[model samples]
Structures are given as structure tokens and as C-alpha cells.
Target: GESVGLHLPTLSVQEGDNSIINCAYSNSASDYFIWYKQESGKGPQFIIDIRSNMDKRQGQRVTVLLNKTVKHLSLQIAATQPGDSAVYFCAENIAGRGGADGLTFGKGTHLIIQP
Candidate 1:
């Protein structure tokens, strides 16, 4: 069963430092994972994604790590800036199931940047 309703986690980091956000999922059958960043009063934006076959994937300044063994996922942001401050979410997509239903999202994590 999925989570009914839950609050997002919170993470605080200093400017220019690296930020790491973690998430845990309950579905072991899921094979696709994505990370999104959402700013205030805005929609969530795509950051990075990884498939179950891959343990890690990297983008420009963002990296996503997937550990199916423990049903864990994480996002790493390098050289964090004030602009990077936002709420991050991890979503899981069950292979061949969510064709039209879409992905299931985690609560999310608030990333705050300190000057």
C-alpha cells in the first residue's frame, strides 16, 4: 500500500556546499525513479532520473543514486547555491504499469540554503 498523506522532509545546507537528499520507497517492483526540484509557488522541475538497472546517473550538476536492495534513493547537488533552494521529490514508476496512470511521488524534501 502507498502512503496516505505525509509531510515532506527538510534539509538545510550552506551556500557553496553540496546537498544530499534521501528518500525511501515501499514498492520493490518499481523499476524507474526520478528526482524533481520545485521552487516556491511553482511546479516541480525535472532534475535527474535512473533506471533499476543502473545504480547511478549524473547530470550537469545533479546526480541520482538508486539502491533497489534497500529500496532507497538519493539525489546529490553539487556546489549548492541560493537558487538551488527548493523542495525536492523522488518519484517511482512501476515498469509497464503506469502507462497512463503515471508515476507515484514521495512526500518530498525541503532544501534550504543558508548564506
Candidate 2:
């Protein structure tokens, strides 16, 4: 289920700088987590993901880290660019709950890029 917040938390970063987004989940039974990037007027796009069995995974310009003990997840974007400005969301999937379509999302965090 999509969890919406009254106000979206925000992070500001300079263009070309690295940006780190953090998220925390409460379900210990969740075995998979994914980070998504959603530009205005569009749905979330896949950024990176990490499984419970793995602590970290890297994509083109993104990295996802998982801390099972804390039920925390984070996404690191290297060399942030203007196009990176968007709302980022973290979703958790409980084991056997479903596949990608069954993810439960957190209130998105808005990433603001400063030129």
C-alpha cells in the first residue's frame, strides 16, 4: 500500500555532489526492499534494490544498502545531477507476500538539486 505523508521530507544537494537517501522499515519479516525515483507527474521508477540475504548492491550510479538488524535501507547516488531531482521512495516486501507489485511504500522524500 502507498503510504502518503502530509508533508514530504526533503534533501538538498548540489549538482555533481553525491546524495544519500535513507529509509527505515518496521517489518522484520520483510525479505526484500527497493528504492524508487519518481519525477513529478510520474510513478516511481526502479533505482536499486537489496535482498535480506545481501547487505549491499550497486547499479549504474546508485547503491543500495540494507541493515537487517535495524530494518533500515539507504540509496546513494554518485555525482548527483539536475535530473536526479525527484521524490524517492523506499518499499518493503514481506516474504511471500507477493512480487514487485505487492510492495508497500513509504512516504517519499523529495530530493532538491541546487545548481
Candidate 3:
């Protein structure tokens, strides 16, 4: 079961623990990646992004890594805080699909911060 009714995977970590969220994209042609964090009633907010040409990119306390060999993408957050509690999603921009805005999103993971 995927954590109750939402059918979303859940990841629980200590309030100050480092957190990593992973996603696997289907299209091998995907060239760009973006990680988003969505809180309880709000829209997904951009966290960080990485291009397929690069293996890793860092922003502030977040790091995004792209593995083209396995079509894998991951977002790592250092010293997670209570504000980090939310649903995290990864979106991919397939090459030559819909110009600049074509993004396919993966099933989100619900990140829960434990006290």
C-alpha cells in the first residue's frame, strides 16, 4: 500500500536529518529535470533543476543529480527542517515534445519530518 489513501510513497526523517528523494523517468530522451515541493494546499514550488548534460547541480542546501545511464534523478536536502515537510515531485522535459514547457511528472513522495 502507498501510505493510506493518497497512493503516494512516504518518507519520514528526523527534523534535522538529511533527506533524499528519488525519481525514475520513463523516456530516455528526457533532457531536463526539475524538483518541486508542494505543501498542503499550495502549488508545487520549484526547488532545483539539472540538465541531462550534467551529472549534478547544487542550489543552496539542495542538490540535484541526474543519472542518464539509468534514467534516474534525485534531490538531496541537507538538514531537513519542519518547513520541508510536504510532497516532493520530479518532472522531466522530454526532448522535442512540446517545446519549452513539456514536462512529465512522476508520482510524488510525501516527506514527513519527525520530531
Candidate 4:
């Protein structure tokens, strides 16, 4: 009956600009967070991740920021391109829970790149 994650339905950004997607998770006990990018007809791809002990982490062109105090998380994309257009979701994993009980995912945010 409890919600695990939260997400915005859509996000629009112009080509070559930066994009920031936000998520709010309900599980304070969750220790791991991951950001995924899913293109149409394709499986979700790992973009970046952060641990509960860390507040921020960065990948090639992406950054994941976690705010445990407010159960907020965000993904930042630098110089977003049309190729970056897709649905992005945030997943939270509780420590010691694995196998069939996998990470809980957010509803996802559809990112549109305006030409």
C-alpha cells in the first residue's frame, strides 16, 4: 500500500541544452539508487548510480544527486541531444533485498528533445 517511488510524467528540452530530471522516493531504508534510460522498443540502460552514503556521483555525461533528507533524487544530463530522448526512471534498492525482490522503480519521465 506504500508508494516506493515518484516521477514526473514528461520533460521537454531543446537540443544541445542541459536537462534535469527529478524523482522522489518513499523508502528511507533504501541504500542504492540507479538512473536508467529506456528508448522505445529497447530495455532500460544503466546511466548512473549513487549510494546512500554519497550525496552525488557523476558519469560520462550524467550526474546523479541524492538528497536523503527529503528523499529526493535527480539526474542531470549535459548537452542533451536528440539521441538522449527517451524515458528515464529512477530505481531504489533496499539493502539485503535481492533476487525476486528487486529494486523498486519510479513511474518514469518521458524526455523529449526539441529540434
Predictions: Cα RMSD each: 2.5, 2.8, 4.5, 1.8
Tens digits of per-residue lDDT for model 1, 13-106: 9999998898888877788888888999999798888889999999998888888897888899999999999989888888765432478888
Residue pairs in steric clash, candidate 1? none
Q: Write the per-residue lDDT of candidate 3 for residues 1-115, one digit (tens) a residue.
A: 2111123389999999998888877677778888889999999899988888899999999999888897778889999999999999888886655433967777799999998
TM-score for each of the candidates: 0.89, 0.90, 0.88, 0.92
Q: How well does candidate 4 score on lDDT at residue 41? A: 100
| Model 3, global lDDT | 0.82
How do all the candidates rank in terms of lDDT, highest first?
4, 2, 1, 3
Q: Determine which window of 10 residues in candidate 2 has minimal summed lDDT.
A: 1-10
Scored by TM-score, the top model is 4
- Which stretches of candidate 4 lie above 4 Å from their native place? 97-101
The lDDT values for all models are 0.83, 0.84, 0.82, 0.88
User: Which numbered prediction scores highest in lDDT against the true structure?
Assistant: 4
lDDT of 2 by residue, 25-102 (tens): 877788888888999999889887778989999999899988888777888999999999999999888876645868
Give one clash count per candidate, in the order shown: 0, 0, 0, 0
Residue-level error in angstroms, candidate 1, position 25: 0.8
- The parts of candidate 3 lying over 4 Å away from their true place are 1-8, 96-100
Worst 10 residues of 1 by lDDT: 1-10
